[model samples]
Target: MRKWGPLVAVCLGTFMLLLDVTIVIVALPDIAGELGASLTGLQWVIDVYALVLAALLLGAGAAADVLGRRRVYAAGTALFTLASVGCGLAPGTGALVAMRGVQGLGAAAMFATTLSLLGAAYRGRDRSFALGMWGAVSGAAAALGPVLGGVLTQGLGWEWIFFMNVPVGAVAIWLTLNAVAPDGARGTRRLDLAGAAAFALFAGATTYAAVRAGEEGWTSGRTLAVFGVAAVALVLFGRAERRAVDPLLDLSLLRRGAFVTVLVAGLAYNAAAFGVMPYVSVWLQTVLGLSPVRAGLALLPLAAVSFVVAAAGGRLLHGAQARFVLGGGLLLIGGGTLGQAVLDADSGWASLSAGLAVSGVGVGLVSPALGGAALASVPARHSGMAGGAVNTFRQLGFALGIAVFGTVATSRMTDVLHDGGAARELAGGGAAALRGTVPDEVLRTAFASGLDGALTAAGVLGLVGGLAALAWVRSPGPEAETEAKAESERDRGDGVPAVGAGAPASPGGA
Candidate 1:
């Protein structure tokens, strides 16, 4: 019971950190109006947070290993709390965006240290159970964010969405200080400044290109330039990784079949499920004429189904091999998302609810198991590194999901609403002004189709993921278990600190 408390504290922090990411999307309209933000500025509000977090995850994990996980974790929570306050008080878009970037840095710190702490606290079956619970909390937090955001935005204002984090962050900080144990102080390693900058540049340029392509045409010179920069940055990043003594991402990890397969499954699951969630809110409001609050209500069934299934699946995780659990879950997710492709303007509530439920169920089943499988393969000492790598890939998948699916949906929107010249320019003004002139049914039907098309692409991606999991994940057999046991025995003999000690510092302080 005592040990469980600390693990639960870290899990709570995980929930709050992740919840902040999705909670803002539904409130973007309100934020823009209140702050007088241009569309580009609003994009920065969303894009920069993710870009910074994704870029720094690896470095942050490495730092926690060297700098002391407890210190880093506490500092991150404090920073996030203070930054949230700054976000609420910011009078302009620029200040708000800057605060969000700071919040992302703090989140990166918190996220990078969590797995190591958990590994430090538990072992064997207890460790597995803790991880499963962590997955369940994350899933619940994700499902709850939009609904909570909608209610808050409508009732109070957009700023309250950020303000809401204050109490939660406070609790997380308090828990960490009392419950988590500090590791033996270790020396720092050399910071990989070049690798960090290169990765950020690559991700930022690519994301900018994707979002810009949605606003402008794909063929625009600006879009081409963005893509070119992304390509160059990626190439340079690869070169830096190869030459660095302590690479942020060890390319060799890709060769490990277990590691790579689970990572792929993680990426695939999020790509399909997350890509469509925000748009589901948009569809309910714009097409079905529901209010934001009502639109959020419509998603409750999906969340409920996912929550229930995820809890049950966590218990089953102890008895099952990850491949079967994850593969089956992906299959269901794919099936559910494919169902979206069949939706039309007149689709009944039962059908929509059923499809969403299926998706939720699939996600419930896979999210935990996939994450567990990935981290389980790495030595406990490498928990932070493994966690960072797993999460970075997942974030990349999420960003790509939104980018790619958003492109398809937006393109379809433009095609359906195509007017000769001047009329086409009118869509840029606002959907409200055009609402009166266009037939409501036609507009609804068009949006439904576009939404479905995006869902189809996501569904196909999930199916691809399922297939990859099946083909690539070699089932664990006696030989594998024997090898793992031998590895553990060898480590004990060599006097390496046990799995929960967290990683020791490299030769130099980074």
Candidate 2:
């Protein structure tokens, strides 16, 4: 019980953070309607959270190593809880977007430390099992997000979606404070302020550019300027890290093919899964005219299949080579996404369901195996950094996916509408304008064309990721496994206390 306490606390926090990623997606239309926000405003609401999270993750991980894992984790929970309240109470689109950024800050801190804390709490085969469980929680939470969001948004209101996080986060904070152990010693590493700033700018600028390009033309001055800024920042960030005493990101890790492969795999998996999800949700509601609850229920097969497959994949990680598992997973995602691309105006729920189930299984297999493999490839001491690296890429991939694929869908839709002689209607209003003014047949056909383009691009990305995994990822060698067992035995021999054993447990040993 003591050993598993920290895992539960961390998982709770992880569940809340990831749940937010997908939960808001289903509620976007409601938010837009109430706030009178444009498509750009809605995109920012989603993008800002991921953008902030990706930018700050590396710095947060370093902070965890220097400050304290439990301390950082608890602070994050408190901040996330507070931010959720603000989100629920927000009066306008801008306010909600700003608050979501704050929420991302808290999420970054919590995500940066959770895997490291888990690594510290368990060792050897126990470690593998614990991580598998952690992976399952992640898959399940993401899967549940849309359904839960639909239920809350439909029954209570969109505000309740954010409000619900408040009580759950409060409990997570309490559990973290009582159940997690303190770091034995803090490292005296210098925080790379310059490197952190540069990296943040680079990521933020790139995301801004992508989003702006979708709204304006790709060659617009604002988009080009931001892209230029991003390029400069990326170069500066590399230089700063190379010279820093204790860099936030270690460039040396990139030289390892396995590490780079896993990072790429993370990016690809998220690009196809998280990136494509928002549009799909919107299509269900806006195009098919399903209510929020029905749309959420319709997504059930994806979540259910993902949850089951992820658990199985985690168990398989103990013996299977990561390359095979990851590669196979990516292939499934590619095939699934390609299947979705075949949808036309005549397609129904059955077509969507079949594709979603395939993608879910792919995500399930890749999610845990990718994280576990990335962490294993790195030295134990740098576990926090490794986790951050993997997540950073995943978030960036998500941002890019949203930006690029969104552009494809929107542009394609516009082109279709224009070719059909509805350019004036589109110009008067965006998708909303089409709802009442345009003919149903015209609207459906245009939307389907846009979806086909987006899904095809996503499928190509997935296939590329699969190829990278097969080429670069490898399983742990025999010596590595032996060393891991030896380390576990040594920790036991030294009588290192299990998590929460030295500290007072929460009430009822939560």
Instruction: Tell me how many clashing residue pairs each candidate has.
Output: 7, 0
- TM-score top scorer: 2
Best by lDDT: 2
User: What TM-scores do the predictions have?
Assistant: 0.87, 0.91
User: What is the Cα-based TM-score of model 2?
Assistant: 0.91
**Candidate 1 local lDDT, residue 299:** 69
Off by over 4 Å in 2: 1-3, 123-126, 376-383, 419-432, 478-510
Error of 2 at 100 (Å): 0.5
For model 1, how does the per-residue alpha-carbon lDDT over 285-312 read when each residue is reduced to its tens digit?
5456566566666767666877777777
Backbone clash total for model 1 is: 7
